[model samples]
Target: MADLGHSSDDTSVDSREENSSQDSKPEFSEDEETLISRMYNLVGQRWSLIAGRIPGRTAEEIEKYWTSRYSTTTE
Candidate 1:
Protein backbone atom coordinates (compact mmCIF):
# COMPACT_ATOMS: atom_id res chain seq x y z
CA MET A 1 0.00 0.00 0.00
CA ALA A 2 1.09 3.57 -0.58
CA ASP A 3 2.34 5.46 2.51
CA LEU A 4 -0.19 7.74 4.22
CA GLY A 5 0.87 11.31 5.05
CA HIS A 6 0.71 10.66 8.82
CA SER A 7 -0.54 8.01 11.22
CA SER A 8 -3.37 8.45 13.71
CA ASP A 9 -0.81 8.18 16.54
CA ASP A 10 1.01 11.29 15.28
CA THR A 11 -2.22 13.31 15.35
CA SER A 12 -2.94 12.15 18.87
CA VAL A 13 0.55 13.12 19.99
CA ASP A 14 0.17 16.59 18.45
CA SER A 15 -3.15 17.16 20.18
CA ARG A 16 -1.72 16.13 23.55
CA GLU A 17 1.28 18.46 23.14
CA GLU A 18 -0.99 21.38 22.26
CA ASN A 19 -3.24 20.77 25.29
CA SER A 20 -0.23 20.51 27.60
CA SER A 21 1.17 23.82 26.37
CA GLN A 22 -2.20 25.52 26.84
CA ASP A 23 -2.52 24.16 30.38
CA SER A 24 0.86 25.67 31.36
CA LYS A 25 -0.22 29.21 30.50
CA PRO A 26 -1.20 31.49 33.38
CA GLU A 27 -4.89 32.06 34.07
CA PHE A 28 -6.48 35.54 34.13
CA SER A 29 -6.69 37.17 37.56
CA GLU A 30 -9.58 38.90 39.31
CA ASP A 31 -8.49 42.33 38.05
CA GLU A 32 -8.52 41.03 34.51
CA GLU A 33 -12.01 39.61 35.02
CA THR A 34 -13.25 42.98 36.25
CA LEU A 35 -11.67 44.79 33.33
CA ILE A 36 -13.18 42.34 30.87
CA SER A 37 -16.62 42.78 32.48
CA ARG A 38 -16.39 46.55 32.28
CA MET A 39 -15.21 46.36 28.69
CA TYR A 40 -18.08 44.10 27.69
CA ASN A 41 -20.58 46.47 29.26
CA LEU A 42 -19.24 49.36 27.21
CA VAL A 43 -18.88 47.65 23.84
CA GLY A 44 -20.70 49.28 20.87
CA GLN A 45 -22.70 51.43 23.26
CA ARG A 46 -19.69 53.73 23.51
CA TRP A 47 -16.50 52.21 22.13
CA SER A 48 -14.21 55.19 21.50
CA LEU A 49 -15.20 57.23 24.56
CA ILE A 50 -15.35 54.39 27.10
CA ALA A 51 -12.00 53.02 25.87
CA GLY A 52 -10.30 56.08 27.26
CA ARG A 53 -11.35 55.10 30.81
CA ILE A 54 -9.77 51.65 30.52
CA PRO A 55 -6.11 52.32 29.73
CA GLY A 56 -4.84 48.79 29.03
CA ARG A 57 -7.95 47.15 27.61
CA THR A 58 -7.94 46.26 23.88
CA ALA A 59 -10.85 46.45 21.45
CA GLU A 60 -10.54 42.76 20.56
CA GLU A 61 -10.68 41.77 24.20
CA ILE A 62 -13.81 43.85 24.67
CA GLU A 63 -15.43 42.28 21.61
CA LYS A 64 -14.59 38.74 22.67
CA TYR A 65 -15.89 39.26 26.19
CA TRP A 66 -19.09 40.83 24.89
CA THR A 67 -19.63 37.94 22.48
CA SER A 68 -19.01 35.35 25.16
CA ARG A 69 -21.37 37.04 27.58
CA TYR A 70 -24.03 37.46 24.95
CA SER A 71 -23.83 33.80 23.96
CA THR A 72 -24.06 32.66 27.55
CA THR A 73 -27.02 34.86 28.36
CA THR A 74 -28.96 33.81 25.23
CA GLU A 75 -28.40 30.14 25.99
Candidate 2:
Protein backbone atom coordinates (compact mmCIF):
# COMPACT_ATOMS: atom_id res chain seq x y z
CA MET A 1 0.00 0.00 0.00
CA ALA A 2 1.23 3.48 -0.87
CA ASP A 3 1.52 5.96 1.98
CA LEU A 4 -0.87 8.75 1.02
CA GLY A 5 -0.08 11.70 3.19
CA HIS A 6 -3.31 12.98 4.72
CA SER A 7 -4.02 15.80 7.11
CA SER A 8 -5.49 15.13 10.55
CA ASP A 9 -9.27 15.34 10.96
CA ASP A 10 -8.75 18.49 13.01
CA THR A 11 -7.60 20.30 9.84
CA SER A 12 -11.12 20.36 8.40
CA VAL A 13 -12.55 21.59 11.69
CA ASP A 14 -9.90 24.28 11.95
CA SER A 15 -10.45 25.39 8.36
CA ARG A 16 -14.20 25.68 8.91
CA GLU A 17 -13.66 27.77 12.03
CA GLU A 18 -11.19 29.98 10.20
CA ASN A 19 -13.61 30.47 7.30
CA SER A 20 -16.45 31.37 9.65
CA SER A 21 -14.23 33.86 11.40
CA GLN A 22 -13.35 35.45 8.07
CA ASP A 23 -17.03 35.57 7.13
CA SER A 24 -17.82 37.48 10.31
CA LYS A 25 -15.69 40.46 9.19
CA PRO A 26 -17.41 43.83 9.18
CA GLU A 27 -18.68 45.59 6.04
CA PHE A 28 -16.68 48.06 3.96
CA SER A 29 -16.45 51.73 4.89
CA GLU A 30 -18.17 54.70 3.22
CA ASP A 31 -15.11 55.49 1.12
CA GLU A 32 -14.99 51.93 -0.15
CA GLU A 33 -18.72 52.15 -0.83
CA THR A 34 -18.21 55.29 -2.90
CA LEU A 35 -15.33 53.83 -4.87
CA ILE A 36 -17.28 50.66 -5.53
CA SER A 37 -20.28 52.64 -6.67
CA ARG A 38 -18.11 54.68 -9.00
CA MET A 39 -16.55 51.52 -10.35
CA TYR A 40 -19.98 49.99 -10.98
CA ASN A 41 -21.37 53.06 -12.76
CA LEU A 42 -18.26 53.30 -14.88
CA VAL A 43 -18.44 49.62 -15.65
CA GLY A 44 -22.03 49.93 -16.85
CA GLN A 45 -21.04 52.71 -19.27
CA ARG A 46 -17.57 51.54 -20.33
CA TRP A 47 -16.99 47.88 -19.64
CA SER A 48 -13.51 47.64 -21.10
CA LEU A 49 -11.71 50.86 -20.15
CA ILE A 50 -12.83 51.70 -16.62
CA ALA A 51 -10.78 48.97 -14.96
CA GLY A 52 -7.47 50.57 -15.99
CA ARG A 53 -8.54 53.94 -14.59
CA ILE A 54 -9.43 52.61 -11.13
CA PRO A 55 -6.52 51.32 -9.08
CA GLY A 56 -6.99 47.98 -7.28
CA ARG A 57 -10.43 47.53 -8.81
CA THR A 58 -11.53 44.40 -10.61
CA ALA A 59 -14.69 43.47 -12.48
CA GLU A 60 -15.71 40.97 -9.82
CA GLU A 61 -15.22 43.55 -7.08
CA ILE A 62 -17.30 46.01 -9.05
CA GLU A 63 -20.08 43.50 -9.54
CA LYS A 64 -20.12 42.44 -5.90
CA TYR A 65 -20.23 46.04 -4.79
CA TRP A 66 -23.08 46.81 -7.13
CA THR A 67 -25.03 43.78 -6.01
CA SER A 68 -24.60 44.70 -2.36
CA ARG A 69 -25.62 48.29 -3.05
CA TYR A 70 -28.66 47.22 -4.99
CA SER A 71 -29.74 44.88 -2.23
CA THR A 72 -29.38 47.55 0.43
CA THR A 73 -31.15 50.21 -1.63
CA THR A 74 -34.04 47.94 -2.48
CA GLU A 75 -34.56 46.97 1.13
Candidate 3:
Protein backbone atom coordinates (compact mmCIF):
# COMPACT_ATOMS: atom_id res chain seq x y z
CA MET A 1 0.00 0.00 0.00
CA ALA A 2 1.14 3.55 -0.78
CA ASP A 3 1.92 5.85 2.13
CA LEU A 4 -0.41 8.61 1.02
CA GLY A 5 -0.41 10.19 4.45
CA HIS A 6 3.12 11.56 3.95
CA SER A 7 4.96 12.87 0.91
CA SER A 8 7.79 10.83 -0.61
CA ASP A 9 9.72 14.08 -0.91
CA ASP A 10 9.92 14.62 2.84
CA THR A 11 13.65 15.16 2.62
CA SER A 12 13.13 17.83 -0.01
CA VAL A 13 10.59 19.58 2.20
CA ASP A 14 12.91 19.34 5.19
CA SER A 15 15.81 20.80 3.20
CA ARG A 16 13.61 23.60 1.92
CA GLU A 17 12.53 24.43 5.46
CA GLU A 18 16.12 24.41 6.66
CA ASN A 19 17.25 26.62 3.77
CA SER A 20 14.37 29.02 4.28
CA SER A 21 15.17 29.26 7.97
CA GLN A 22 18.75 30.27 7.19
CA ASP A 23 17.84 32.69 4.38
CA SER A 24 17.68 36.44 5.00
CA LYS A 25 16.35 39.20 2.79
CA PRO A 26 18.87 41.69 1.58
CA GLU A 27 18.65 45.17 3.10
CA PHE A 28 18.59 47.67 0.27
CA SER A 29 19.74 51.15 1.15
CA GLU A 30 18.26 54.49 0.14
CA ASP A 31 21.36 55.10 -1.94
CA GLU A 32 20.86 51.85 -3.85
CA GLU A 33 17.22 52.72 -4.44
CA THR A 34 18.24 56.11 -5.77
CA LEU A 35 20.78 54.47 -8.04
CA ILE A 36 18.25 51.97 -9.33
CA SER A 37 15.78 54.75 -10.03
CA ARG A 38 18.37 56.79 -11.86
CA MET A 39 19.47 53.80 -13.90
CA TYR A 40 15.85 53.11 -14.79
CA ASN A 41 15.53 56.65 -16.09
CA LEU A 42 18.66 56.39 -18.18
CA VAL A 43 18.12 52.87 -19.48
CA GLY A 44 14.37 52.21 -19.20
CA GLN A 45 13.02 48.67 -18.36
CA ARG A 46 16.40 46.97 -18.81
CA TRP A 47 16.76 45.13 -15.53
CA SER A 48 20.03 43.29 -16.19
CA LEU A 49 21.74 46.45 -17.33
CA ILE A 50 20.38 48.34 -14.38
CA ALA A 51 21.56 45.62 -12.02
CA GLY A 52 25.01 45.82 -13.60
CA ARG A 53 25.09 49.51 -12.79
CA ILE A 54 24.16 48.79 -9.18
CA PRO A 55 25.86 46.41 -6.74
CA GLY A 56 24.78 43.51 -4.53
CA ARG A 57 21.49 42.75 -6.30
CA THR A 58 20.53 40.31 -9.05
CA ALA A 59 18.46 41.56 -12.00
CA GLU A 60 15.50 39.44 -10.97
CA GLU A 61 15.54 40.76 -7.40
CA ILE A 62 15.88 44.34 -8.60
CA GLU A 63 12.98 43.91 -11.00
CA LYS A 64 10.76 42.33 -8.37
CA TYR A 65 11.46 44.95 -5.72
CA TRP A 66 11.18 47.87 -8.15
CA THR A 67 7.95 46.59 -9.68
CA SER A 68 6.45 45.94 -6.26
CA ARG A 69 7.11 49.49 -5.03
CA TYR A 70 6.43 51.24 -8.33
CA SER A 71 3.58 49.87 -10.41
CA THR A 72 4.30 51.99 -13.46
CA THR A 73 5.54 50.13 -16.51
CA THR A 74 9.01 50.84 -17.78
CA GLU A 75 7.52 51.31 -21.23
Report RMSD (Å) for each prediction in the order shown.
8.7, 6.6, 8.1
Worst 10 residues of 3 by lDDT: 19-28
Q: What are the lDDT figures for the candidates, one per model?
A: 0.56, 0.56, 0.78
Instruction: List pairs with backbone clashes in candidate 2.
Output: none
What digit string (tens of lDDT, one per residue) describes model 2 on residues 1-75?
A: 133334555677799867854552325667766765686565563523544555665555445545555755642
The C-alpha stretches of model 1 lying farther than 4 A from their native spots are: 1-44, 72-75
Give me the candidate number with maximum TM-score. 3
Worst 10 residues of 1 by lDDT: 20-29
Shift in Å, residue 50, candidate 1 = 2.5
Model number with the top lDDT: 3
Model 1, span 3-62: residue lDDT tens = 354676678899987785455332345776576567646564454444455566545544
TM-score of each: 0.33, 0.37, 0.58
Name the runs in model 3 displaced over 4 angstroms: 1-26, 72-75
Report how far off residue 68 is in candidate 3 (Å). 0.5
Question: How many clashing pairs per prediction, in order?
Answer: 0, 0, 0
**Tens digit of lDDT per residue, candidate 3, span 20-48?**
54444434689988998999999988999
| lDDT value, residue 50 of candidate 2 | 49
Which is the better candidate, 2 or 3, if ranked by TM-score? Answer: 3
Winner on lDDT between 2 and 3 is 3
